[model samples]
Target: MNFREFAAKNVHRNVKAYFAYFLSSSISAALLFSFTMIILHPNLGAIDLPEYLIKALNITTVIAYLFLFFFVFYSVSVFLKSRYKEFGILYIIGASKKQIQRMISIENMIISSVSALLGIIAGLVFSKILLAVSGKLLGFNALEFYLPVKAMLITFIAFVIIGIVISIFCSFIIKEDMVLKLLKGTKKPKTEPKTSTILAITCVVLLTTGYYLSVTSSTKTLAGRIIPVTLMVIVATYLLFSQLTIFIIKLLKRNRTLYMKKTSVLWISNLLYRIKDNTRMFFLITITSTVALASIGSVYAYWRDKEAQIDRSFPQAFFFSDIYDNSSMVDEKVNFIEGSLKNEGIKYTKVNDEMKFIIPKGEKDQVVIIKEDTYKKLSSILYLNAANLSENETILAMPLTKHGRKNVVLENIELEVASKLDKGIIPAFYEEVYVVKDEAYEKIKGVKVYFNTINVKDYKNTLNISNNYYNNFPQDNVNKYYNNLLKSGILRATKVAYGVILFSAIFIGLIFFVTTGSFLYNKCYMDIIEDKKKYNQLNKIGLTFKEIKKILNIEIGVLFLFPYIIAVIHYIFAISALKYAFELNIAVPSLQVIFIVLIAQIIYFIIIRKNYLLEIKKSLL
Candidate 1:
C-alpha cells in the first residue's frame, strides 16, 4: 500500500483515541471564530461604545489564537510519544529514517487538516449564538449577524499554517538515537528509578518561599513580584512531582508493616513505577491547571466585587450638584436633563435638597449637615435606616461618629447623637456628615450645596440618555456634575468591558481544562498495554480480579487527585493575595470557584478511571 493509504488506515483504526484532541481543537476554533465574528460585526460602528472596549476585545481574540498554538504544540508532542513504538516497528522493517519522518509528517498533516475543517464547520454552526450573547452583554441593541467571510478565511489560513509549521517541526523531532528509545517504549527498565534528596529538599524550600511571597507581598509590590513568584512556584511544582513524590513513595516502600498491608502491597508495587514514569506529565498538568483556575477565579472575583464598589462610589444614578447660592445658575442644566428624560419617555424620580457645611471663618475644614427630610429620602435610596431627629438630635454618617460619641458640636451648634448611618448618603468629598431637623439645619450659618438626584427606574436606559446629555451639555467648571458623566461613564465601561473579560476568562479556562483532560486521557491509554501485562502476571500469582480493580482505583485516584490538590492550594494563596490588593472580601467568589473546579475534576476523574479500568480488564482476559 502507498504511504497515504497506510496512514489513512492507521488513523481510522485509532479514530476513537484521537477523538478528544480533535473535539477540543475544533471547539477552540469555533470560539475564536465567534470572537472574530464580533470583531467583524458591522453594528459595532453603529453603537456608541468606548474605544478601549473594542481594543480589549481585539487583544483578547489575538491572545486566544496565540494560546491555541501552544496548546496544539503540547498536544501534538504527547501524541508523537504514544506513536513512537509504531514508528520503531516500521524502521525495523527497513523503512529509511527520512521515509519514516515523511510518513509521520504526512499523517499529522492529515489529522490537522481534518481537525481544522471540523472546527470551521462547528464555528459556522455556533458563532452566531455566541455573538448574540456577547452583543447583549455589551449593550448592543442590534448586532447584525451575517456570514463572517474574513473570520473564516483568517481562521482557515492561520490553522493551516500552524499545521504545516508543526508538521515540519515534528519531522525534526525524530533523531537517530530516538529509534532505540522508541524500540524499548513501554518496556520495564532494567533498573528502578530513584529520587534525588537534594532536589526533594529544594522542592520544599521553593514551595514554602513561593507561598510566603504570594501571601505576604503588599499590594504596592505585588505587581512587581508576579514574575518571580510564578517562576518559583513552577520550579517547585516540577520538583514536587519529579523528586518529592518519588521520595515519599520510596519511604512508603521501606515501611515493611504498612507496605505488607492489604492493597498497600499491590499499590506500592504498581505506584513506584507509575510515579517514576508519569512525574513529568503530572508536573505539566499541575502547572497548566493551576494557571487556568487562577485566571478564571481572579477575574470572577473582580467582577463580583464591582457591584459594591459602584454603589459606594456612585450613590445615585444621576445626581446634579452646585453651590446653593448658584442653584439658579444650575437650574437650566437640571431642567434640560429632566425634560430630556421625559422626552425619552423614561420614568424617574427627583430629590431636591441642599447639604449645609459649616466652615469656620478662619479654618479650611468643613462638616456636612443634612436636613431631616433630605436624610430620610437619601437614606431610603442608600439602604440605610433614617432615625427621627429632634431639634437637638443628630445622626452622624459613617466614619464620622465611629467613636460612639453621644454629642457632636459643630460651629457653636451642639446636637445629641440619635444614630449613625454606616454608608454614604450622597457622593461626598468628606466622610463626616450630620443629620439634623430642618429647624436646626436652617438655623446653622454655612455654605449651602444644592444637589438634585434623578433616580431612574432602570439603570440600563442611562447609556443612551447619558450619551445624549453629554453630547448637549458637556462638563464645564460650573456644570461639573450636570450630566452625571463620571458615574455614568464608569457604569457603562464596567458593564461592557468587565462583562467581556469575565466571559472570555471563563471560555478560555474551560478550553485549558479540556486540553488538560485530553493530555491525561491519552497518557492513561498509552500505559494500558504495560499495565495489562504487569497485572496479568499478578493474576497468575493469585491476585483476584476484585483486588486488582481496587488497586487500579487507588492508582488512578492518586494520579488524578494529586495535581488537583496542589493546584487548589496554589490558587487559594493566590486569591488571598488578590483580596488584599483589591481590598474586597473575596470569600464568596473564592468558594464558588473552588466548588466549580472541584466538581469538574471529580467528573473528569470518574470518566478516566472507568475507561482505564475497562482497558485493564480487557487486557487481563
Candidate 2:
C-alpha cells in the first residue's frame, strides 16, 4: 500500500492506539505553545524588563519543552510496548523493515500535526486566561493577554524536529523479534519484592539524615552547600517513597491476627503488593506531589511576609528615595506626598535616615546559614534575602550609627571593607551585624541612597496610602521602582497562586483517579473472571458476588486511607518544624491541605464504590 492508504488503514485498524498517541502529542504541544506566549510576547517594550528576565524566560521555556519532550518519549515507549504484537504481526505478514519504518514515520507525523494544532489553540486560550487572571489578581490594568506568534512558530518547529528524531530512533530500535517474543504474553516474571528489613532500615536512616541536615544545619549565605543538602533530601524522600510502604505492609503481614483481621488488613496488604509491582509510578506521583506542595507553599509564604516588607519600607502614605541624592523627583514627590496625606486627614513626619556604612576587617560575601525566622530579623536590619546556604562566614550589613568614623578591622578602598548604605543592611539585634560610619560607606561606591521614612496613623491604611501616592505621581524615583516591582510581582503572584490551585486539583485528583480508578476497575475485571470459575467453585459452597463486592469496598476504603493517614501525620510534624524555622504565628496549611485531601478521597470513594455497586447489581440481576 502507498503511504496514504497505509496511514488510512492503520488509523482504521487501531483508533485506540492513535488516540493515545494524539493525546500525548496534544499535551506536549500545549505546554510548548503556552511557553511561547510567555517568552515571545509582542508588548515587552511597555515595561523596561531586564535582560536577565528574558534569559530566565528563555531558560524556563527550554526546560518546559524538555519536560514535555521527555513526557512524550515516555508515552511513545509505553505505546510501542503495548503494541509490540502488532509490530510482530506486520513482520509476520511479510512487511519489510523499511516499509514498517515508513508507516511508523507517517503515523508519527499525522499524530504530531493534529496534536500540534490542538495544542496551539489550547495554548493560546490557556495563556490568555492566565494573563487575564494574573492581571485581575495583581491589580494591574494593562492586560498582557495575547497569542504569541513567535512562540507558536518556535514550538511548532521544535515539536516537528524533536518528534521526527525520536520517532526515527524508536523505529530503528523496535526490533521485530521482541514483539514476536511477547506475541504470546509471558507468565509473571520472577522478581524480588523490595520489602526486606535491611532496605527499610536504610530508607529510614537516609531520610532522617537528609531531614536533619535541612532542618538544623545553617545555610545562610552559602548557596553552594544548600544545593547538595536539598538534593540529598529530595533523593532520600523519593527512595523512601519507593520502598517504605511495601516493607511496612510486609512486616504487618507477619502477624497472623493483623494479616487476617478484617477487610482493611487484607486490602492494605493487597494494595501494598500491587503497588510494589509499580513502584516507579508511585514514586513519580509522590515526587510530583512533593514539588507541587513545596512550590505553592513557597509563593504563599513570600506573599504573607510581603506585608512586613511594605510596612518597613513604606511607613507613610507619601515617601521618596534617591541614590547619591541625585534625583530632582524626590523633593517634588515629597512635597506632593505631604500635600496628598494632608488632603486625606493623615498626619506624618518625614524622618531623615542618614546611614553610616561599616566594614569589618576581612572577607567579602560573608555567608552564614540560619533558620529562616532568624534570617528575617537579620535581613530586616541587613537587607539580604534568605536562602539555603552551605557556608560558615556570616555576612551582615548594618547602617552605621555615627556620621563619620573608621572602626573596622580592615581598611582598604577597593577591598577596603567600606559600607554600602543601600539595601541589605544588617540589624543590631543580631550579633552578626556591625555598624560603621560615613567614611566606611564611602568604601562601597556602587550604591548611595537617601531614604525618607515616614510613619502614619494606621497600619491598615499604610498600603492604600502607598498605592495612591505611587498612582498619582509616576515620575518619582521611589514610585518608579515600586511600580516596576508591583507590575512584575502581580504577574508572578497570580501565576504562582493559580499554578498551586491547578496542580492541587490536577495532581491530587489524578492520583486519586488512577489509584482508585484502577482498583475499582480491577475489582470488576477480577469478578468477571473469577465468577466464571472461582466464583462457581465458591458459589457451590454458598459464596456470592454480593459478599465479594462488600469485602472489596471495605478493602478499598482502608487501603486508600493509609496514605492520607501517613501524609497527615508527616504534615503536622513538618509544619511544626516549619513554624520554628520561619517564625510563623498564624494559621497553618496542614489542616487546609488535609481538608482538601479528604474531599478528594471522598469523591474518589463515591465514584469507585458506585462503579463497584453497579457491577455487583448487574451481576445479581
Candidate 3:
C-alpha cells in the first residue's frame, strides 16, 4: 500500500479508539460554527438588543475558539499516547520517524476535514433553533437566518488549522528513545502506587478550610476571599485524587474481611493501579464538572429569582416625591398619573406622607423623618405592621438590617429607638427613615419633602400608565418620582440581559460536560488492551463471565462515578457561597441542576460500561 493509503487504513482500522476524539472535535467545531453564524447574522444588528449583548457574544465566541484549540490539542495528545505501542510496532517494521510523522499528518487532516464538514452541516441544521433561542432571550424579534458563508468559511478554516497544528505538536510526544517503554505500555509497571502522607493530610486541611470559608464568609468578605478559596479548593481536589484517594484505598486493603470478599479482591486490586494511572484525568473531570454545575446553577437561580428581587426593591407601584416647594409641579404630575389610572379603570389606593430631612448630632448623613400616623397608613396599604412610637421614641425602617434599640440625637432632640422594620415601606431612594410621633415630628427642624406612594390592584399591568407618566414628567434632580412602569421596563431589560447570560452559560456548561465525559471515555478505552489481557487470564482460572462483568462494573463505576460525586460536593460549597453572597434562596434551582447532571452522568456511565464490557468480551472469545 502507498504511504497515504496506509495512514488512512490505520485510522479506519482503529476507529473505535478515535471515536471519542472525533466526536469531541466535531462537536467543538459545531459549537464554534453556530456561535459564528449568530454573530455574523445580518438580522442581529437590526434588533433592539442590549449594547453589551453583541459584545458578550463576541467574547463568548472567542472563548469557544480557545476551548476548541485546547480540547483538540489535549485529545490528540491522549490519543497518541494510547497508540505508542502501535507506533513502536510500526517502527520495528521499518517505518522511519519522518514517515510516521507524515502518516500522522495525513490521518489528522482526513479526520479534521471530515469533522469540519460534518460540523458545518450540523451547525446549519441547528442554526435556526439557535437563533430562535437567542431572539427569545434578547427580547427581540425572531432573528432571521441567512446563508452565513463567512461563518462557514471561518469555522472550517480555523478548525482545520487547529487540527493540523495540534497533530504536528502531538507527533513529537512519542520519542525515539522511549521505544522500549512504549512497547511495554501498561505491562511494565512493577512498583506499588505510593501516597504522600503530608500531601494527603494537607489535602484534608485545605479542603476543610476552603469549604469553611466558602460557607461562612459574608458577602462583604466573599469577593476578596473568592480567589484564595478557589485556589485552595482546586489544589486540594488534585491532592484528593492523587494522594488522599490512594491512601484510603491502601487502608481499605488492610481489612482482611472486606478485602477477601468475592470480587472485592479482584476489583480492588485492579482499582489501585487504575486509580493511580487515572488520577490526573479524574482531577481534570472533577474540576471541569464543578465549574459547569456552579455556573449553570448560579445563573439559573438568578434568572428565576429576578422578579422576587424586583418586588423587594420596589414595594410601591407608583411613588412620587419632591421638595414641598415643588408641590405645584408635583401636584400636576400626580393629578395626571391618577387621572390616567382612573381612565384606564385601574383600582388603586394612594397614601400621602411628608418627610423631613434632619442631620443627626454626630452624623453627617441626613435621616428621613415621618409622622407615626402617616407610617401607619402606608404600612396598612403594604400589609405591614404599624409601629406605636412614644413621644421621644422612633422606629427605624431599613431593609435587610438588624439592630437593637438605640438612641439618636436629631437636631438636639434625643429619640429612643422603639422598634425596627426589616421591610422598607418607602421607596429605596430614601436611605434611612425614622417614624416618630406627630407631635415629635413637628418639633424637628429640617427641609420638608412631600411624597405620595400608590398601590394598584394590578400593579404589574400598569406598564403603559407608568410609561405615560415617565414620558410626561421624566425624572431629574428636580422631578423625583419612582414610576413602577419605568422600573419594570428597566427590570425587563435586566432580565433579558440575564437571560442571555443564562443561555450562554447553559450551552457552555453542556459542552464542558460532554467533553469531560468524552475524556473519561477515551481514557477508559486506552486501557482496554491491558484490561482484556488481565481479565482473559482470570477467565482461564474458572472466573465466570458473570463474575468478570461484576468486576468490570466495579472498576468502571468507580472510575466514572467518583469524580462526579466529588464534583457535586464541590458544587454544593460553591452555591452555598453564592447564596450567602446574593442573599437569595437558590437551593431549589441548584438542586435541580445537580439532579439533572447526576442523571446525565449516570446514563453516560451506563453506556460506557456496556461498551467496555463488550470490548473485553470480544477479546476473550
Candidate 4:
C-alpha cells in the first residue's frame, strides 16, 4: 500500500483514540463560525445594536480561536504520546523518522479536512436558531440569515492553519531514544508517588489567605488586590492537587484499620497511582471549570438585578428639573409629557417640589433642602414612609452617613437632625438631602430649583410617550429629566450589551466543560490495555467480577468527582468576592448555575463510568 493509504488506514483503526479530539475541534470550529456569522450579518448594523456589543463579539471570537489553538495543540500531543508503542512498532518495521512524519501529516490533514467540513455543515444547520436567540437578546424582531460565505471561509482557513501548525509541531515531539522507551511502555516499574510536606502546608496557607481576602476585602481594596488574590488561589489550587492531595492519600494509606477494609485496599492502592498520574489534568479541570462557573454566574446575576438597579437609581417614572429657572420651557415640557400620558390612557400622579441648594454656615459643600410637605406627598405616591418633623427639625437623607453629627446651620436657621435615610427618596444625583419642616424651609435663603416628579401606573409602557416628548423637546442633559421609558431604553440597551457577553460566556463555559470531560474520557481509555492486564490477573487470582465492579466504582467515582468538588469550592469563593464587591445579593442565580453544572457533570460521569466498565469487562471474557 502507498504511504497515504497506510496513514488513512491507521486513522480508521485508531478512531476511538481520535474521537474526542475530532469532536472538540469540530465544536470549536462550529462556535467560531456561528459567532462570525452573527458579527458579519448584514442586518446586524441595521438593528442599531450598541457599538460595544459588536466589539464584544469580535473579542470573544478572538478568544475562542486562541482557545482552539491551545486545545488542538494539547490534544494532539496527548494523542501522540498515547501512541508511542505504535510508533515504536512502525520504527522497528523499517519506517524512518521522515516517513513517520509524512504519515502523521497526511493523517492529521485528513482529519482536519473532514472535521472542518462537518463543523461548517453543523454551523449552517444551527445558524438560524443561533441568530434567532441572539436577535431576541438584542431586542431585534428579526435577524434574517443569508448564506454565510465569509464565516465559512474564515472558519475553514483558521482550522486548516491550526491543523498544519499542530501536525508539524507534534511531529518533532519524538526523541532519538523514544523507540526503546516506547517499546518498554507500561513494563517500566513505577516508584511510589512522593510529596513535599512544606509544599502541602504552603498550599493550605495560600488557600486560606486567598479565601480570606476574597471574602473579607472591601470593594475599594478588592480591585487593587484582585491580581494578588487570583495568583494566590491559582498557585494554591495547583499545589492542592499535586502535593496536598498525594500527601493526604499517603497518610490515609498508613491507617491500617481503614486501609484493610473490604475492597478498600484494592481501590486505595489503585487511586494513589491514578491521582499522581492525573494531577495536572485534575488541576486543569478545576481551574477551567471554576472560571466558567464564576464568569457565567457573575453575568447572570447582573442581568437578573438590572430592574432593581434602575428602581434604586431612578425612583420616579418621570422627573423634570428646571435648572435654568426657565418656567416657560418647564411648563411646555410638563404639558407635553402629561398630555402624552393622558392620550395613551396611562394613569399617573404628579408631585411638584422645589429643592434649595444651601451651603452650611462654615462648610463649602452644599446640601439639598426640600420641604416636609413635598416629601410627604412624593413618599405617599412611592408607597414609602415620610419623615415626621416638627419646626426646626430635619431628616438627613444621604448614603453612608455617620450619626455622630447633631445639627446643621443653613444661613441663620438651625435644624435639629431627627433621623437619617440611607438612600435618597429622589433621584440619586442629589447625594445629600435635608428634608425640613415647611416653616424651617421657608426661612432658608438659597437658589431654588423646581422639579416635577411623576409616578405612572404602567411606567414600562411609556416608550412612545417618552419618544414623543423627546422628539418635541429634545434636551441635551439627560440628568435634567428622568423618563422611565428613556431610562428603560438605556436599561434595554445595557441588557443587550451584557446579554451578548453573557451569551458568549455561557457558550465558552460549556465548551470548556465539554473539553474537560473529553480529556478525562480520553485519559481513562488510554490506559485500557494496562487495566485489562491488571484486572485479568486479579480475576485469575479469584477476584470475582462483582467485587471488581465495586472497586471500579470507587476508583472511577473519585476520578470524576474529586476535581469537580474542588472547582465548586473555588467557585464559591469567587462568587462570594463578587457579592462583597458589588453589594449584590445573587445567591439564587449563583446556586442555579452551580446546580446545573453539577447535574451535567454527574450525567457525564455516569456515561463514562458505564463505558469504562464495559471495556474492562471484556478482559474477563
lDDT winner among the candidates?
3
Q: What would the per-residue lDDT of candidate 3 be over residues 1-621, giving only the tens digit for each residue?
A: 899898999999989988888887788778878877876777776655667876777777777677767777777788887888888888888878888888888888888888888889999998888889877766566788889899989988987898689777977787767788778764664679999999999999999999999987664688899999999999999999889989988888999899999888888878888888888889988998898899889888888888777666667887777777766665677688789888989888888768888888888778888888988898898899876777788888866433443998887889998777767778655757888889888988998987877787666687787777768765665322322234455567668788778877877887787778778888888888788888899899888889999988888899889999999999999899877665777889988999999998899899889989998889789
Query: How far in Å is the alpha carbon of 534 misplaced in model 1?
Result: 1.0
Model 4, position 208: C-alpha lDDT score: 96
Candidate 2 residue-wise lDDT, 391-480, digit = tens = 222223432211132333423432222333323232222223333333433443333344444445553444454566557756434322
Q: Write the per-residue lDDT of candidate 4 for residues 59-82, one digit (tens) a residue.
A: 888777887788777777877888
> What's the true lDDT of residue 384 in model 4?
78
Residue 281 of model 3 has an lDDT of: 88
Model 1 clash tally, residue pairs? 0
Better of 2 and 3 by TM-score: 3
Cα lDDT, all candidates = 0.75, 0.50, 0.81, 0.81
**Against the hidden true structure, what lDDT does model 3 obtain?**
0.81
The Cα error of candidate 2 at residue 69, in Å, is 0.8
lDDT (tens digit, per residue) of candidate 1 on 1-621: 987788778778887677767777777777776667777777765675568766767777777777788777777777777777877888788888778777666666777677767777787786667767777756455466688788888877777877777777877766656778888765645467778999999999998988888877664578987999999999999888878988998999899999999879889977887777788778877887788778888887877776676666566777777786668756666687788788889887778888877863344657778888998998776567768877788887753123446887766777888776656777644556778888877778877778777766566566676777777875675432232433565677777777777767776777677777777777776777678888999888888889988998888888787788898899988887786554556799889988988898889899888888887788778
Q: Give all TM-scores, in the order shown.
A: 0.78, 0.64, 0.88, 0.87
Task: Name the 10 consecutive residues with the lowest summed lDDT in model 1.
Answer: 477-486
lDDT of 3 at 143: 83
What is candidate 4's TM-score against the reference?
0.87
Off by over 4 Å in 2: 1-28, 123-128, 137-139, 142-148, 192-194, 212-225, 261-273, 312-347, 353-452, 456-579, 584-621
Positional deviation of residue 525's Cα in model 3 after best superposition, in angstroms: 1.1
Q: Candidate 1 versus the native: TM-score?
A: 0.78
Error of 1 at 322 (Å): 9.0
Model 1: how far residue 480 lies from native, Å? 11
